[model samples]
Target: MTANKAVGPTEAIADFVQQADFSTVPVEVRERALAAFVDTVGVAIAGHGDGGFQTLLSTMRPELPTGRATILPTGERTSAMMAALLNGGAGHALDFDDVADQIYGHPSVVLVPVVLAVAEEVGASGRDALTAYALGFEVCCAIAATMQVREHYQRGWHSTATIGVLGATAAAAHLLRLDHTRTRHALGIAASTASGSRQNFGTMTKPLHPGLAARDAVLAAKLASNGFTADPAQLEGPLGYLAMYADSADPSAVARALGNPWELARVGLNVKKYPCCYNTHRTADAILDLVRENPVRPEDIAEIRLTLEPDGFDPLIHRRPQTGLEGKFSPEYVLAAAVLDGKIALASFHDEAVLRPAAQQLLRRVSRHESAVPPIGSGEWEFAYSVVEVETTGGEVVRHRTDVPRGDCRAPLGRDDLEAKFRDCVTFAGTGLDADKLLDELWQLETTGSAGPLLNLSASS
Candidate 1:
């Protein structure tokens, strides 16, 4: 993964990771990253029982060593690597973590968990943890920028796990304070294990992808710090990470992306309003807009049509999902639930909510189609959008389109909305965690003594 710092992207990245400091990060970027921590912890709390995580933990708990690293809401202690895996998976179990359009994956789920766990293991200060996270995110976005990524995504490689492993590695390596040479080795170790298939979408395995990435990253960094070695030229080599994964590799993409404009400041992160596949957010927002304005009853609707540009429906594979997890990926299910419930809440994704007779009948009334047209000036379909049209039994048609749903960088949720979301998830999980105290702690994370106690503070009684 090492390239010349003055001459190549990957090397410049290693240099950046080694040198990054929290005080040097801009105020706005730090604030956004802080908000990301609060949102991620809240959603992960709500995802406690979903994704078959409890069952998976039953198998792991017997051998899991008790340590300072804490799992969200559970108050349980485990080794740093196990905590990272558990917390990362739980953070993404609801698919509600922040997203970056650049990578088409959740960043905080991988970076935050890795930073927190490794920071705890190393007794690093919160300021250092926060800086490590930003560095990791930049590295993740940098790698994604280095190729013709449409193929990597279209071919079903979940970049969150594939690219995110390296991000996690960068964060952990930085927190571990590995020098440039060891950091390169850590990234190389990460590349060797980075993998997550899009085929796992809609299943428990989907959320587990980020957890595995987090675990692999911690392992990679710890190993490199302990003198493990890997192929130094694992990035742009003829058969390296980028060569094998990217359809078309760019020799300079990585160099151009790493902080030239600062991806965090440019692309920014998306705070999700709904707890489902991000691909379905536009459709959810659009359909909800249509129904709330029209005041049409579910039974009075004859058909609901969802239209998008090519590959828009690629991640929405389950049309008549039989389970709650499956419903998270179903536009049909979301449209039906949104129309009936007035909002897409944590309750909306429960098995009973998904399988209820009314929801199932309404689901059948939805039909999805794709086209090749963008919104005149949007340029490409990569910036995904959705169009929803509702036709009532009286033949009345109403339509709505959502290009940037609320909570997007352009249409961010306000502070009250963000805090309300955190409080709601706490209540929904019946966690009894101190939401107000936790919110204050998160906002002041940079000044805190250690990052580990923050999670322990949020643990349910």
Candidate 2:
């Protein structure tokens, strides 16, 4: 009854795992591995008290003392699945995590949590975790590229929940040292575990998706490593991930650059400067540029208009956000905060701020329109000629067009900017913790033998 099909992402990635050893991995991949791991830790620390993070932690608390793994933000030990769930939720809580352009999702949201949880459970060193993480991130990106990702995501699926589940499976498989055959089983198991939706955006469920993916990945790997089996063609089969989730998928993109180290070299990872929707970044850039050039007294502006591609506007289409969480996906709310308040600080997303009269009034003056443009890939909307317009009291029009902006992979934030952002997140995390010391610990994470020091600091705070 087995129907043969071309190898899918699951099979392609499994082959690499069967043959790869620490010696064969390129040096650049090793370095990227280290960089991503550190970034994930930083974001997790900054997301400590987010409602989603706390809820996930509480849900997994019953599994504590399982003596299998360490949960970041709390040095508590738990089952590998439980640890992955908690740490993964923390990493994505702030929405300030890193993004891989090829996948158009937060790969580390699942990869780091699963790898770190498994590493700690097995007493694996930092080196092992870093190596496995690199492979996982690469696999995730390749599959996403092959999937004609934009189309897949537009259909209501969340890439981090769908693609990230596969990435987490790869990382867990690598850490568990699964053979090629068993790794395929892990991927197959993960296919069944994949689930999340874009409709959940702006709600507590959004962050929870990545956590669930991480936990599912851990469970998949453990089951596979212990001889649990699944259909080898789970990804390409009629009932598989691609067939079920995407209308069309190009398998060649997955195999084209199989061994080229594409992810580490060119895909370009972006770190977020703010914790809101990425779509709003273009407008934020333009608005900030205008603010710097002409301190438009908030009272002087008549109204503001923003134009974005349909795909870009789709995620942030919410008109009137009734809650702070909902405000995260509202372009109007984000723009209002940036222009009127002169900053989009975390406090701007609190309950009271979301319902503020001034915020709502400012939001009313602003209008968002979806442009008539075609997108090349998932999350890469038409950045060309995107404009934010401001009408002044004197009948003057002040406008800023964003081709790109700081913190984007194209116009990346420098080390100084990244440090500034980290400090800002630390401040938002509340006062008692020493921001400088925590930042230093992250900068030196690769050299640290275990995550013990970082976990200790987070727990104490």
Candidate 3:
């Protein structure tokens, strides 16, 4: 294959489209894809009843065509695009979706939903869908690598909603097997779909961002497949995605290390154990470890202080969170719930618990500060704590710090751990989706020969 002289937006996307295929993915990548798949479905189903997600679904129901793709929680069948948007929105509804550290974004939010919807629409095998996920996952990480995502996100763009469109577009293009030109057009069209704001982080709009991005990505690809056109220089031109979105733009990074290296292999995504923002993970881990090693009763602690990276401090900066949804992003609320309740389960976010007197009292006593370096890639400098000083009124002080947080890709959860987490999520979702059969089918998806059973679980109410 001859490489293009100058990589235009469409050409760059087309190149990836031609190079990627189901057979190209390795076994490890396939396993990770399965992990992401089951995790997203579980979370989405669990959050299917959320007011924001349900409202979005209801609104979209009347506008979509009848199709094979299933609407999770309610088991309704709808067009692939509609299913993508609804499920994508629901996945992040609880704010417990996956995150990518290097990109300062959420990759699975849009990628998983879009890919799965297409899988159902095309009758793609589980193995093929998993491969599509791997391809999409790699592309998402690559764009982030080129964009200097941390800076881009800090300057106000929500990476999950913005960078995710390109990745999702790539996935849809690859699965649809569009030639390089059409693929490029899809990428170009996706540029317009890029949108999200950090101001909505603690609110319902935050989760909706990814859902809309997923739907938009499918639309972009579908339009491209139908011969719709877009700017050929949307990514590399002087006034492209970088120029328009970031403070400083680098066009070279967009195509740098295109063949020899891949960003997806280097920048591993974070699989969240707690249903809270990624910034709060390290602190929650620190508290959980402290309580475990030297178990302390709720009444024994007097005050607590949490230190975080500069970027980490901003996301969960809420002081007074009145609702359970707001409480998920509030560091104070999470810390209080973790300390007072001993476990921050799905129920921890219940309205009554969030408004509880003891949780509020602990919330008042807890304070968070900034660290020197931003905790991003590699577990080394990510989130190091000084000492969690638990000033006890009984003339004693307890201290602990997290060397490494659980579910940190480095110290990742094992198969058993993941299974437990999936079961927990399924139970909380109240979907009655068979856990054992689902896991078995997912693991043996390559030869399953039918997506109906898998789709049925998520489709039925």
Give the best candidate by TM-score: 1
Off by over 4 Å in 3: 1-10, 258-264, 373-387, 450-454, 458-461
Q: Per-residue lDDT tens digits of candidate 3, residues 1-461?
A: 22333555345556766787667665567677777777777778778667888788778777978888877656778888898888888999987778777567778888988988887787777766776777777777657766778788887889998989888898898777777778887888899879999988877899999989999989998999999988766776676776777666545554543432444455455788888887777778778777877777777777777766555666674777888888888878877887877777878877788999988877888776666642332334644443355777686766666656787777778878777877787788776778776667556666655445346665322
* Model 3 lDDT on a 0 to 1 scale: 0.75
TM-score of each model, paired residue for residue: 0.95, 0.90, 0.92
lDDT of 2 at 202: 85
lDDT of 1: 0.83
Model 2 off-target regions past 4 Å? 1-6, 22-27, 372-385, 434-437, 448-455, 458-461
- Output the better candidate (1/2) by TM-score: 1
Q: Summarize candidate 2's per-residue lDDT along 260-370 as a digit string, tens digits.
A: 654765656777777777767777777888788978877777888887765677667477998887888888888888887877766878868989888888888887766
Candidate 1 on 160-182: residue-level lDDT in tens? 88989988898898888899888
The lDDT per prediction is 0.83, 0.75, 0.75
Off by over 4 Å in 1: 1-6, 374-382, 450-454, 458-461
Cα lDDT for residue 363, candidate 2: 84
Worst 10-residue lDDT window for candidate 1 reads 1-10
The 10 consecutive residues of candidate 3 with the worst lDDT sum are 374-383
